[model samples]
Target chain A: MGIIAAIDLGGTAIKGALFDGTGPLTKKNHPTEAKKGYGHVLQNIDQLIQRMADNKGIKVDEIRSVGVGVPAFMAEQGRRVVLAPNLGWSDVDFASDLAEQMQKPVFCNNDANLAALGEHWQGNGKDIENLLMVTIGTGIGSGLILNGELYQGKSGMAVEVGHMVIMAEGSHRCSCGRQGCVEALTAAPAIVREAKKLMDVPTDCLPDVNITEAKQVYQAAASGDKRALQVVEKAAYFLGVALANILNFYELDVIIIGGGVAQAGDILLNPLRRTVARETVFFQRRPTEILPGMLGNDAGVFGAARWAALGEAKKRG
Target chain B: MGIIAAIDLGGTAIKGALFDGTGPLTKKNHPTEAKKGYGHVLQNIDQLIQRMADNKGIKVDEIRSVGVGVPAFMAEQGRRVVLAPNLGWSDVDFASDLAEQMQKPVFCNNDANLAALGEHWQGNGKDIENLLMVTIGTGIGSGLILNGELYQGKSGMAVEVGHMVIMAEGSHRCSCGRQGCVEALTAAPAIVREAKKLMDVPTDCLPDVNITEAKQVYQAAASGDKRALQVVEKAAYFLGVALANILNFYELDVIIIGGGVAQAGDILLNPLRRTVARETVFFQRRPTEILPGMLGNDAGVFGAARWAALGEAKKRG
Candidate 1:
């Protein structure tokens, strides 16, 4: 039994968890000033992993491997971030560098993909073989598990479901600079943007409340606010449209919705179910189940641990 | 070496070919008269197979398997045609019925899918894995071969690339009753319709010309007719759009273009390449090689033979 360090690299904070052969032993979080240069963040991760390992009474040599989750497309063979729009980094050899510093086998993958794997290993998708984990945060992201394996396709960019065009000629600019991306319209920020357009919202109720906050939009919708409800429904429509298209393409059994905006619960799910049912071509054949994510915020950390476990298994084999 | 009986079931005729392990020993064609009854067609296939095998000096017992192809979605288990809009057949269990009479293992699949598989086995895709074979004929149809295996999704409706929406709001009625289907605008008939509306060609100039016949459009386009060229280019645009989308989803190495319309060669391919270059989201990342199919009219027959071979292998394993 060896310890493995799992790192969830977010924009604001770098979350790390140390796991002994079985489960997590300790967790740590530190602010990531990405603008300070990439080198600084790299050093920060190395130090954090070491500190976590030390706290757990494990030596650096005792740790079998390290799993790092980043926000981007990871190449299948190289395990490098091919394109990460969020980090403003390109062609970064993350795995090799992380391995060099940590002095162990390092495995890197898309954060959402690792999250899906995490959920598959210990969360709601534990019993399911074919599952789609749709994360609804500031941006909509998805990770697909097809036929009991992570289908990364030829280039490991196969499951870029968020970039898929849900609505043709949709009037929204996605973070990826593409139009009609499911992420552009269905994400938390997009929901808030839609809710802010209501002329009567400010005067009627919550006069000084900011519309940019996704939770405010959810609260207003929960209070029977017409504009807020429409905004949430529209977001759900796009999400459902994308989910339906994916269902038709891959034909998965269930879609687990996670992330911050998924907190809206029934308000988001009801409209999404309606839109998915109406838009899907094979609605009559079999209906896809939409369930809330069970792993919550620790999904990425759990997934990172799962990734390390799998890597250890592969190495042992 | 065992002889294999292959059947290519078309709307007008049933083409039968007998293969002695590698190449065709003898070929025979007969009127299908599908509108009459399913039993009549089945009997015709039986007689046709017998005649071909006899001509090749092969005993009925020496024949390994009978492979049949249809213009519809084959069920996951390859037992029946789940849906064939053109043939107006649903859940037709041709396998059990044909197997009972032949007293041998029988295999059947979608003609387009078989064509793709046939190409993969002996034609253009022989050396390549992870290919998308698109047949541009009466309607656009595709078959995906991923990781050296035919990807038949959950409901055996995997590579339905033609039905994918190209123009979210293109004013066209797809044969599937869906609007904005790539097939609706890019199919051979659609090209001819656009050509006829744009050009005034004399009957003598293009003999035996019809909007439904892809050859007519190719003829006009080849003769330097401006309108015909425009129509072909338009179709190529939509076709390229769908292909690019597929490329984004699956980073395939090659896309083998087949079917009757693909006979036009560069008249369709040149524009498709250019359009795919401009439209594909991942155009800057993974580069895909597109080429015309080599199997031509014999693709289905060869595919049937290959399918039979696969079935035998599976049974042995």
Candidate 2:
């Protein structure tokens, strides 16, 4: 059984897992510190892989391939990042650069796309063929899987469901320079922004809620706070509308909601399902199933490993 | 060496054409008079095919297959019309009845979808692989071809681009009960409706102008009529916004404009292109090539023929 190394590359940290054809056997984590520059991050990936290989008492050749899940639009084969705003990079040739240092084949794609793939392959949507895995963290993102294959549109930027305009002249401003996008109103900061505007809540109200994270809005909503509930409901409506638009557009069988916001569960799911059901035009038939992510935080790593294994399979085929 | 029969089933008339397995050779036109009942219409089709086959000294089987394009949603191997508001049909087994009468395998699909496929197979989009054929007629209809294959979504209702809501609180009401659909604002009647709303258009000022056809407005605009041009520009802007939304969503390579309103040509195309370029997010890198449809009115007949030919190929395969 060949070994596949999966890496979830983020701005603050890099998590690596070693899988022997079946599942993870050992894992490692390291700080990314993206502001330090691309070279430093690349160096960190190289050192982490070396340490993992040494711990298993195996040579570099013993590993079959390595897969990476990044937060960016991959043009094709995940060789270069077209534009990753979080990483503060443009057109970085991470695939070739990493292969040169690690001396192994590397497969890469957008982290959200990979998470979707991970969920489709090994999580809730295992029995389903067509679905979308939406990741809602600080920003909103999605990976579309159609006809049992990843639907990367022309130029590889197909499923921008997050930026899909929900309101024509909506008040919220999305980071992508578009107004009325679902992400503009539903993302983490948007929730906090809405909370601050709803009440003259002190700075301590926010700090006490999360201290270090923005996901606490869900917690407040879960705690039965009226303002927080309204904020979450607003996000749910936009998400539901966006999902309804998606359901209207694609006729998808299921949509798996992931990311930090999904932790609120019923606080978000009930309204979302009702809104989507009400908003959808063709409600006579089966409605799109909304489910929680089964893979959780490990989804990106698992998806990356799946990407590597599939690449190896394709090469042999 | 073989001839194929193509039929366009309309509420008012039934249009038929004979092709020598390549292009149209002879045409036969007759009234559908569907209110005369289903059996009469079936008999009409039988007589039409018999007359054409006898005139050419050919057996019906030598024609390969018969294709019927209906203005409705067809499914379950074209054995039924899933829904068609215009024809007042619901789950009617039109295809099977037609195939049984003709004693040959028959294929059926929505007329607009077939038109796009026809354009892709032999008309304007012949050279382009990823194309979106948008027809601006009685209603806005679209047929999408992606990666060289016709993309029908999970429930076979994909590519209903006309119903895509462009305006949230839009002033116009669509035929589908949706508010602010592109079809409600830019279709032929919509263009005419806007022309009627223009203030102080003395009845004699633009003699060619009327509130029935888009061509009247085009003629008026050509004669340097300000009111006519304004209406045309408004319709064109809405169309451009809709196209921009589609491009932002799908990243299609080519968009073929067809149907009655498309006759305005450059008057509509020029403003549409400018608006789309301005509204689209990735306008610089991913430019969608907008072009005029080549098949004109014959697109429906040819598309019907192609739809029929697919069944013929499958039987022989």
Best candidate (score: TM-score): 1
Chain A only: TM-score per candidate: 0.94, 0.93
DockQ of each: 0.32, 0.33
User: On residues A55-101, what C-alpha lDDT tens digit does candidate 1 reach at each position?
Assistant: 87777677788888888767864387777666777788888887887
Kindly provide the TM-score of model 1 when superposed on the true structure, using C-alpha atoms.
Answer: 0.90
- How accurately is candidate 1 docked according to DockQ? 0.32
TM-score of each: 0.90, 0.89
Model 2: how far is A292 from its true place, Å? 1.4
Global lDDT scores for all candidate models: 0.78, 0.77
Q: For model 2, report DockQ.
A: 0.33
Runs with alpha carbons beyond 4 Å of true place in candidate 1: A50-62, A166-179, A189-210, A213-215, A278-285, B54-62, B154-158, B168-173, B192-230, B279-285
Clashing pairs in 1: none
